[model samples]
Target: MGFPRWSRLGSDLRRAPGRVRARVTTARGRGGPSRRRSRTSHADPPRGGSCRPGRVGSRPHLRRHPRGHRGGHLLSTARSGDSGGECPLHRAAGARDISRCATSPPRHREAGGVRSLVRQPSRAFVSVRRFIAFGVAIVVIFSTLTARLYDLEIVRGDYYHQLSEQNRIVRLPVPAERGGIVDRNGYVLARNIPGFAISVIPVDLSRTREDELSQRLAALLDLPSDAIGDVIRAQRIRNPYEPVRISKTPVPREIALVVTERAELFPGVRVDPESIRFYVDGTLYAPVIGYTGPITEQELAKLKDSGYLPDDDVGRTGIEDVYEQFLRGTYGWREIERDAAQREIKTLALQRATVGNTVSLTIDDRLQKLLDAELRKGVDEDKFTQAVGVAINPQNGEILAMVSIPGYDNNMFARGISTAELAALNADDRHPLVNKAIGDRYPAGSTFKMVTGLSALSAGTATRDTVVNVSASSFSVSGTTFYDWRAHGSLDFVHGFAHSSDIYFYTLAAGTPFAPNVHGVGPDAIAKYARMLGFGAPTGIDLPGEDGGIMPDPQWKIATFDEPWTIGNTYQEAIGQGFVAVTPLQLLNAYASVANGGTLWQPHLLKQVTDAAGKTLPIPQWTSQKLDMTQENLRLIREAARRVVTIGHAYMPNLKIPIAGKTGTAEFGASAGKDSAGRNKLGFHNWFVSFVPQADNTDPTAQIAMAIFTYDSSKSLCELCLNPAVGMTQRILEQYLGPNK
Candidate 1:
C-alpha cells in the first residue's frame, strides 16, 4: 500500500542519490518550444521537484519561499499549471500526480535556449510572514503608551492636582477691625463704628449678564456704570473669584439693603460691614489724633506684601500715622465651596479676625478742652489770629494738653473730604492744618535770653553780680547802634534778665567798649548754650511734622545770609533777637528742662498699648538728658525766672499758684504804620513761657511747664502791654488751678 513517503524520500528523490527535477510548463501547455514564455504567464511547476512512476510519495517536497517573491527558476514554486513536462508524473491513473503526463529534468530550452521563469509564491508563506511583522508593531506601540502613562501619573501628580483644586476653589479676604485710640483718662479720641460697603464677585456673574449687572448696581448706588464695569474688569484680570469693593468710602444703608434683598437683580453683589473712624471733638484734637483715608497707590505698592488689600484704609497723619503698625490688626478668611452656578454650597473653613490694639495717650482730655477754650477766647477777643499752647509734665515729657488755634475738624477727612473742601483747607491763609504747636517756627525773643544768661554765667563771662551800665535807650559798638526795648540805669545779671534788659545781656556777650574788666564771650558761647538747652532742634514729639528751629552762629550766619559775623550781631544774638528761631514745643520743652532743674525729656504722647487679648504692652520711655552745668547755677537761673513773674515787665504776680517764667516780645516784621521817629515800627510776636509751684522747682513739685505763643498782637491798639499770650496763659492757670470747676 505504500511507496516511500516524501518525508522518507532520500536526499534528491533517490534517483541514485541526486536531484532529478521534472519539467516546467506554461498555462497554454507549451513545453520546450522555440519561443520563450511571457513574464506574466501563469506557469506550472512540479512541487515534488521530481516525479516517479506509479507513486507520488517518493518525490522530494518543495520548501515555501521565505520572502514570498516571484519570478525565480522554474523548480522554485508549487503552482499547478501543468502545460509541459520532463519527468513522467505516474504511469498509472491512481497517482498523486494524477495526469499520466511525461516530465523531464529541470527544464531546458529544447528549441530556444534555457530562459528565466516566474514562480508564483505560496499563500501560506506570505500569510505567516505578515502575521509576525504585525505582531511586533502592536507590541512596540503598546509599550510606548504604557511608559508615558507611568510618568504622567506618578512623577508630577501633585503639581497637576493643585492646578485642578485651584480651579474649583475661590478665596475671599475678611477685613480686620482697626484699633481704637483713647486719652489718658480713657476718653475715646478715635474709635471704629459700624458702616456699610458694597462689593462684587466677578466669577459669580455670567459674561452675558456682566454689563447688565454693572448698570443695575450703578443705578442703585447712584454711581456711573462705566466705573463699576471698570472695577469688575480689573478684578477679573487679577482674580475672577476675589471680591472687589465698589468704593473705598462707605455706601448708604438703604442701597446696601436693596442689593441684599433683591438678589435676583444684582447677581454678584454683596453687602459687607466696614469699620469707619469716629473722632471725638474732632477740631479740638485734630493735630494730635489725625485722620484715616483710603490706602494710596504708592502706599499699596509698599504694603502689598504686608497683607494690605486694595480697599484698605490707612492712617494719613498725626498719631494715627505714627502707630499704624500697631493699630492695623491681622486679617482672617472664610472659605466656602461653590457649585457649577457659582452659588455658595457649603462652608469649608473659617478663620476669625483679630481686632486692633487700643492705644492710651498721655494727654488729658479735660486739660486739653480747658486749654482749647481759653486760647480760642483770648485770640478771638484780641487782634491775634494765630496761636499755640502746649503743656507738659517737665520731669517726664508727657504732654498734658496741647491746642493749635485755627485747627480743622479731622472728621472732615475721616468722612472723606471733597476736592473743593481739601482745596479750601490748602488755600486758607491762616493755615488751619499747620499744627503750630510743633510745625511752625518763630523767633525765641526773650525766652532765648535764658540760654544766653546761663551760657555767659557758665563760660566765665559773667557772675550773678556782673552788671553793665545803661546810659541811654541804645548801645553803640564799632559805629553800629542797637536799640533796646527799654533802658535801665545799671543792672546785674539776675535783675538784667528779670527786667529783660537788652544792653545788659548784650554787653555780657559782646563786652563794653570802655570797660576792660568785663570780658565778652560772643555768639559761640550763646550757640553752645542754646544747643545745650534743647534749642534749635525738634523736641522729638510723637506728632508728625515737627520742625527743627534755627540757631544762627558766625558759621550759620555766613551759610544762611552769606554775610560775615558782626559784634552788633553778637549783641542782638545775646538778646534772642538777631538770628534765632524755635517751635512752640521746643521752647516749652527747654523751659520745662530748666523748670525741672536742667533735665531735657523727649516729648511724647503715647503712654501704653492694650492688645485685643486684654494685655497691656510696654511703651518706649522718653529719652532724657541731665544738664552738664552745676545745680547751683540752675537755681540762680530759676530765681531770675521767678523774679520776672514778680517784678519784671509782665508783672503778673498773683494767679493762684506760685509761678516763675519769662515773657518775650520777639520783633518779626515792620508794622503797617511808622513810628514817631519816621522809622518802620517793628511787630512783636508775644510769648509766655512758664511753669507752676516754684518749690526750688524739682520734677515732682513743678507740675507743668507751658508755652503760649500768639502771632503779631502789635496793632496800635494792642502793643506789647496787651500781649494776648499773657492773658491767655493767665486765664488757663486760673481755670486749671482755682476750684477744679
Candidate 2:
C-alpha cells in the first residue's frame, strides 16, 4: 500500500523519539498509576502533532519533575519539523518548510499506519489534583492557627486573666484620726472634733447630672456653682473614679443630716465623717503646742512614703511638727468590687487605720496662763515692742511656764487661715510666729554682772570682801568713760552687786586706781565663766530655732570686727553690755545653774509620750552638767544675787519669800545726742533673771529660775522706764510665790 501524507509527519516525530520517550517515563513516575494512565491515553497526541492540556479547562496540575527534565518534551517537538500533527511550537514558528520532508526516516515512511503516542489529560485528572493541593493548604493553615490558640489560651492565661480582673476592682483610702496633745496635768491642748465633709465621685455622675449636682452642692456648701463645676472637671481629668473633695470645711450638723436624708436627690455626692483639729486655748499655747495645716507639696514629697496623701493635714511647727511621726496616725485602705459603671458592688477587703500617739507636755497650764497674762499686761502697759518670759525648775530643767506676748491663735491654722490674714501676721514687726522665749536674743545686761563677779571670785582675782572705790560716777578706760547709774564712794563685791554699781564691776573686769584693788579678771575669764554657764550657745531646749547668744572675747573681737580687745570692751562685757547677748531661756538656765549650786540643766518642754493604748514610751531623759564654779564662789554669787533683790534696785521689799535676782540695762543703738562734754546718750534693753529660794537652800526641786526681757527706746534713761523687766519679774514672782510669811 502507498504511505499516506500524514505518515510523512510521523517520520519527523520519530526523529527525536529517544528524548520523547524519556519525558514520557518521567511524567508517569510523578503522577503515579492514575496520573500515568490519564497522561498517556486521555490526552494522547494525534498522528504527528504534540498534545498539551487545554489552558481554559482547569488550573495546571503541577507534577514534580527531575532537576532538568521540565519542558524537555516540548523543546524536542519544536526542533523536529514533522510534529506528527500541528504542534503548538510549529504554529508559533509559522509555516513549516517542505524542504525538510526528504530527511524523514525511510522506516517511518514505510509504515502506512501511524500510532498516537502523546495523550491529552482528562479534566477529571486536573480537577482531582487541584482539589488535593487545596486540601493540603487548608491543613497547613489550620495547624498554624492551632499553635497560636495554644499560646494565647494556655501559655500566658493567668497574666491576661489578672488584667481582666483589674478593670472591675477599685481601692479607696480611709483617713485616720490624728492624735491628741495634752498638758502634764491631763488638760487637752489639741483634740479632734467629728465633722462631715462633702466629696464627689466623678465616674458616678453623667455630664447632665454634673451640672445639677454642682448647683445642689454650691447651695449647700455656700460656694459658687462654677467653682464646684471646675473642681469636678479638673479632678475627673486626674482620677475619674476616685472621690474628689468638694469641701473640706466642716458642714453644720443639721446640714449634714439634711444631705444624708436627701441622698437620693444628689447623685454621686457623699457626706463622709472627718475629724477637725481643735485647740482649747489655742492662742495661749500656740508657741509650745504649734498647729496643723494641709500637707504642703514640699512636705508631701518627704512624707508620701509614710502613707501621707496630698489632701491630708500635718503638723507645721512646734511640738506638733517635731513629733509628726507619732502624731500622724497610719492610714488604711479598702478594696471594693465595682461594675462597669463604677458602682460599688461589694467590699472585697478592708484594712483599719491606727490612731496616733498622745504627747504630754511639761508646761503647767495655770502658770502658763498666769505668765501669759502678766507678759501681755506688761506689753500693753509699757507700750513695749516685744516681751518674753520663761520659768524653769532648776532641779530637772523642766520648763514650767513660757510666754511670748502677741502670740497668735493656733486655731486659725487648724481651721485654715486666708492668705490676707497670714500676710498681715507676717508683716507685723513683733514676729508673733517666733517663740521669743527661746528664739530671741538680747544683751544679758547687768544680769551678766553675776557671771563677771563669779569669774573674778573663781579666778581668785577678787573675794566676797574685795573692794573698789567709785569716787566718780564714771570710770575712764582708753578714753571711753564707763558710767555707773549711780556712784558709791567705795563698795565690796557683795555690796557692788547689790547696788548694780557699774564702776565697781568695771574695776574687777579692768584694773582701776582704788585702795585694796586687784588685777582685772579680763575678758578671757569673763567669757569662760559665761560659756561654762551655757552662754554663747543654745540652751539645748527641746524647742526648735533656738538662738545661741554671743559671748565676745579677744579672739571674737578680732574675728568679728578686726579690732583688738580693749579695757572698754572688757568693761562693757562685765556689765552684760557690748557683745554679751543671751536668749531669755539661756539666761533662765544660767541662773538656774547658779541656784542649783552649779549644775547646768538642759531645758525641755516634753515630759512624756504615750500610745493610743495609754502605754508610756521611752522619752528623752533630763540632762545636766556641773559647771566650773567652786562651792565657795557659788555661795558668794548666790548671796550677792539675794542681796540684789534685798538691798539693790531689784529689791522687792514687800515680799516675804526670799528671792535672788540681777537687773540689767543694756545700752544699744546710736547715741541720740551727746552730753555737754560730748558723752553719747544710748537706748536700753531692760532684763532681769532670778530664782526663788536663796542659794543656801538645799532643796533642788523647790528652786524656780526665771528671766524677763523688754526693750526701752526712751532717751531720758528714767529708772522706771528702763526697768519694766524688773517690775514684770516681781509681778511674776508674786504670782508664783503667793503670800509669803
Candidate 3:
C-alpha cells in the first residue's frame, strides 16, 4: 500500500533528527495541551493490559522529546515497568513515545530481548532433568531393598529354613514292650496285654469342629465330653501334631469296630494298638508285684532326658519300682512328613525299640498262695484288724512266702483307678497296701526271751543248769513291783525259756536277792545280744520301705524318751517288754539264725535278671555272716524253742516232725487293763516264731523258719484259745513237711 502523508511525516521525523528535536523542544518549553496529551498517551496501561487482535499493530501517539534526554528517559521507564509489571517489554515497547524508538541504545534493547528469552524454557530440557532426578531416586530405594534381600535370602537362609521345616515335619514315638515279672516257678506275676487306644490329633480340627469331634469320641468311648475336650485342648497347647491318648484300657470290641468303621465321622480321632499292664493273680500278689501308672510331672522332670515321655506308664511300687531300669524298655521313634492339616504324608526314617529284660523273683507261687489263703482264713475267723505271715529258708535267707491280708487287685492302678476308688483304699483304717510281714513293727513279747537268756549265758551270768528260785510270783525292782504271768517255785535257764517264766528272766536280767551269788546280765549285755540278732537295723532286703525294729539301751532310751534307764525298765525288757520291738521278718530271721547254727543271712527277693533273649545277667551274690555266739548256746535256745512248742503251751501237740517254736502275747495300748465297759479288755498282739527240726536233729538243711503276727482291735483272746497265727503256722508246717513226716 501507498504510504499516507502522516506515515511519511513520521518516517521523515525519525530520519530528520534536527527538525524532530526542534519540535520536541518546542513541546517541552510550552508545557501546553500538546505536551499533556503526549504524557497521557505514553503512560502505562492500567497495570495489567490485555492484547486485542485488531490492535496488534496499534501504537500510542508519540510525543516529541529532546534527543539528549530521550535515552535516559526510555531506560528509566523500561526498568520501572520491568520491576513490577507482568509484561514489561510489551508495555514499554507499546508506549507512544517515538523518542524511545529513535533514541534507546542497542545494548539496552539487547538486554530486554535477553530477559524475555529467559522467562520461558524449552519442553525437551525440562523433561530430561525430571527423568534424571526420578532415575536417581529409584536407584537409591532399590539399592536399600537389595541389601535387605541379600541378608534374608542368603546369609541367614539355613536358620529360617529349619524353622519352616519343623512346621512340616512331625515325630511319632514307638513304645517298647515292657518286660514280664515271673516267680521262681516260671509263673508270671506281671505282664503286658495288647489293647486298643484312642487318640486325638489336635491340628486336624478347628476350634468349632473340636466340640463335634469330642462329642463323637465321648459317645464312642463312653467318656465325659468335657474330659475329651480338656485332653484335646491341652495337647493343642503343647504340640498340635502329636496325638493325645484318650483311653488305653481295653475297649469293647463293638465300640472299636464302630470307631474303625466310622473313622470319617470323627475327624482327628485314631484307634491304635497299645500294651496295658496285667497282673496275674493280682490281689494275691499285689503287695509283692505292685502296679504301674502314667508318669507324673515330678517323675517326668527327672526322667525326661532318659527317654521317658509324659504319657509313659511307670512302676509305682514294690518289685516294679525297685527294678524299673531293668523292666522299662528302650523307646523308638519315626520321623514323618506331614501336611498343614497334620495328615501324614510319608515316613522319612524309623528306629526300632528294644524289649525290656525279664525279672525273676525268688518267691514260690504255690507256697505264697497257701500262705495267703491261711492268713485270710485266720483274719476272717478271728476278726483281726490286721495279720501277717512270713516264711524263709533259714539255710539261705531266701523268702519263701510273705503274706499280708486284706490285699487289693493291683490292676486297678494299671487300668487307671478313679479318684474316689483310690481315696477309699487310702482311707481304710487297716492298711492293705502295706507289706505287713516286713513293714509292721510290734513288741516282741515273750518271743524276745531267747535274746535275754542267750545274753545271760554269753555274758557268763548263767549256765544251762543255773537255777533261779522263783518262789514269789512277783519281784521288786527299785521299789517297782513286777509280776510274772504265774509263779513257778524254781526253774533252770533252759526251763525258764521253755516255760516263758517272767520272774526267772527278771532275776537273771536285774539282780535277785535269792540268787546273790550270780550277777544279773544287766541291760548292756541284753541290748548287745539284741543288736547282734539284727534288731534296731534293717534286714537289707531288696525291697522298698522296710522298717527296722527297735532294740533299746540306756543311751537309746535317753535319746528317744529323754529318760534315764531304770531297773524296772531292765526287768520289763528282760521278758521282751518295755522298749523292745521287732518286725515279723526280723523275728523270723533271728530264730533262723539259731536254727542255722548262728549264721545270719542277708535276706533278698530277686533271684535273677535275664534279657529278652533269655541271657542271664550277673547279679550280686547272697551274703551271710556268722553270729558272735557259741554253737552250744544256740543249741540250748533251739532246744528250749522246741520244748515251748511241744510242752510250754501245747501249741503243737500232734506234730510228728521235730518242731520248735515260741509263743508271744504282747500287751498293746493303755486300755489293755480294762475297757469302758470294764470287760477284760486287754489287747494283745499274738506272735509265733518257729523252726522245724530241733537243733539236735542231724538234718539241718530241712529246717524252715516262720513268723506269724496277729492283732485284733476288740476282745483279748488267750494264746492257747484263739491263737490263729499259731494255727496257721501249724498248717503251713504240716503242708510243707508232708504232714510232719
Candidate 4:
C-alpha cells in the first residue's frame, strides 16, 4: 500500500521547521468511567472543576447526554475501526466525538478495581480445583485400605487368626526340681527341704515409700543398707517392676518375724516357698558326695548361652555334677492372663512342669560310716597332715566306703558357706575340700608290685617259681643302689614278695631273662599293663574331677620331662617309682582285677535312673574285659600276697577271714624326722588292698578291698598307718564275711 494523504501531510509537517506540537492522554477511573484530556477542555473548564468525557475511543456511535438532569452514561468496549482500543461513550455521545476521549486522564480507581475483579475468580477457581483433586485422592486411598483389611481379616482368615492367637497366648518355662540323691540302702543322702524366702516386687512399692521401704527392709532383713538402696534405685532406673530376692532359705523364726512385721515395714515384701538342698548325713561323705550352690553370674552367662534360665540349679561336683542333666529335670510353663498394668489377673491356661529324676548310688551307708570312724581314728592317731582310705567291692568294682581326712561338714555348703567360714576351712594346712579317693594321685609304692607280677606273667617272661638269690639287702642297677626294707636270705618268688625283698625284684629286673632288655619291664610294657588295669585313664566313675592318674611312658617322658627313656627309668617304674603315679581309686580298681579272677569291670556310682512314675529307665550297660593270664600264676601271686598278712607277720594273723594284702612304704624326699625310737625314720605311704573269698571261684557278697595311706613326716621303718586298716579289716570281715576260709 500507498501512504494516505494525512500521513504524507504529517510527515511533511514533521520535516517543516518550527512545527506546533500536540499532546493527548487518556485516564480511566476504576471500572466506572474514563476521563478526557483535551486542549479545548483545559480552557473550557476552570481549575479544580470536573470535565466529562464526550467520547472514550474511536468508532463510537452514541450521543452525549446533557449535564445534570439525572442522565446515565453508557460505555462500550469495541474493536476500533482503525486500531484495537476500547471505545467508551456517554449515553448522548456520537461517533464523531469518540476520538476526543482517547486522550484522557489516568484513573487510579479503575486500575485497582480491574485488578481486584480479575483476581477474585482466579482465586475461586484455584480453590475449587484443589478441593476436587484432594477428594478424589482420599477416596481412592480409602478404597484400597478397606480392600486390604477385608483380605487380611476374612480372605486369609486362618493364617492371621493363628498369628493373633500366638500374640495372645504366651508360653513360659517352669524349671524342674533337682533329683534327690540317696545311698544304696535307700537312706537319703541329699533331699530338698521346703522353705520360704523374702522377695520384693519393685513395681508394687509406691514412689513416696521407696526409700523408706528400703531402709525398713535393711533393718529387718539385716541386709546391707547400701545394697538395699542400690537395689531400689536400680529397679526404678530399669523396669521398676521386676521382683528382687531379699533373702533366700529363711528359717521359720525369720519367716514368722517377717510375716508379723511386713505390713508395717514394707509394701512389696512377700514370702514364697523355695526349695533348699539338705545333706542328711552332714559330714559323713562330704568330699565324695560334694554339694551344690546357687548359680553364679559367670555360670549363668554360660548357661544362658546353653538355654538355661536364672532359676535353674546346677550340680558343682562329684556324682551331682556328673549327672546334672538327669538330675535337673525338664521345664514347662503356664499361660497367665494379666492386665495392661501387668497385674496377674488369672490363669488363662496352665501347663505343669516335669519333676527331676531320683538318683540311687552304689555306696553302702553302714560300711561307709564304719570306714569313716576307723579312718578318722587312724588320721587322728598319726596326726597326719592328710590321708585317704577307700574300700570297694572287688568283684563288681562297687565303692563300699571312701574316706578323706580333715573331713568337712557338707551342710556348710548345703546352704552356702560364708566367706569367713570358707576361709577358716581352707586356712587349716590339711585340705578339707580335696576328694582324695579319686582326686589324689600318689606313688602306689610296693602296692604296684601285683600289677608288675601280672604284666610279667602275661608277657610270659616270668613264672610263679621264679627265684632270685640275694647276697645282701641291696642290689645295684646302672650304678644306682636300690635297697629292700628288710634284709633277707635266698628267696623264691613267694618269699621274695612276702618279705618285700627289693634285691629279689631288682635282680629279676636285671637278671638273664630280663638282660635282653633289663629293667624287668620297660616304660612301654609297664604303661600297657597300667592301662590294662585302668590306670592312666578315667575309671568311668560317676563323679567329676576323678583324675586319670599318671602312667609314665617313653612319649610322656619326652613330652613332660624332656628326657629319654632309659634302663634306669624302666627299673624305677618296675618298682612303682619314677613317674608312675596312681589315685587310690585306681589302685583299688586294679586289686578288684585280681579279686574278680582277671575281669575288669567299669566302676560306677549311678546304679540306675528312673522316672517319676517309678518306671525304670534303660540301665547303662558296660562291657567287661578279662586280662589273659593263667589261673596258676594268679593263685601263686595271691598266695604270696596272703603270706604277707598271714604267716609272714603278726599283723596277718589278726585278719579274721582269709585276707591277702601287701604293705607299701615308698620313700619320697628326705628322711629327716624320727619316730619314738631314735632312728632314721623314712617317709612312707601305707596301703593294704584285699578281697574276701565267698566260694572257690565266686566273689563274696561284698568283696572288700581297702587302700589307706597315712602321711608320716617321721621316717619310721615300722609303718603305723597299717594298724587301722588291719584292725578295721578284721572287724569288718568278722562281722560280715564270717571266719577264715
When sorted by TM-score, best at the front, the candidate numbers are 3, 1, 2, 4
Over 1-741, each residue of candidate 3 has an lDDT whose tens digit, in order, gives 121234443454455433332111111122221111211123222111111111113443333222323453322222211222212323444443222332222222223211111123446778999999999999999999999888888998888889779868867788898899998888999888876777888887788898888888877665688998999999999988778888745454466678788878878877787778899998888888788877889999999999998778888888888889999999889999988766789999999888899999988888887778887877777677788888888988888878887778898887667566788889987788888777878888888888888899899888999898878777666577887767777788778887788888877898776577768899989999988989889898877878998888899989988999988888879888877888889988888888888889998778889997799988778888988998888888887887777777535777756678888877876355665687656677788888887433533443578888887633554443455667778877777776333
CA lDDT of each candidate? 0.74, 0.74, 0.73, 0.64
Residue 474 lDDT in model 2?
Answer: 69
**lDDT-superior candidate, 3 or 4:** 3
Candidate 4 regions with alpha-carbon error over 4 angstroms: 1-175, 206-234, 246-267, 296-307, 425-429, 477-479, 512-519, 670-682, 695-702, 720-724, 739-741
Segments of candidate 2 deviating more than 4 angstroms = 1-153, 163-171, 196-198, 204-234, 246-271, 514-516, 670-682, 694-701, 713-715, 720-722, 739-741
lDDT of 4 by residue, 616-706 (tens): 7776775567876676776777777777776553255544467777766666655757667886655766666666665433332337777
Worst 10-residue lDDT window for candidate 2 reads: 22-31
Q: What TM-score fits each model?
A: 0.74, 0.74, 0.77, 0.71
Quantify how close model 3 is to the true structure by its C-alpha RMSD in Å: 12.0
Q: What clash pairs does model 3 have?
A: none
Clashes within 3 Å, all models in order: 5, 13, 0, 22
User: What's the C-alpha lDDT at position 394 in model 1?
Assistant: 88
Q: Could you tell me which 10 consecutive residues in candidate 3 have the lowest summed lDDT? A: 46-55
Clashes of 1: 5
Q: Residues 334-445, candidate 1: write the lDDT tens digits.
A: 8877765556677788898898999999998888988898778767786577878899998789999899988999987876675668999999988999889999898888
Screening candidate 1 with a backbone cut-off below 3 angstroms (N, C-alpha, C), the clashing residue pairs are 29-83, 86-103, 86-104, 87-103, 87-104
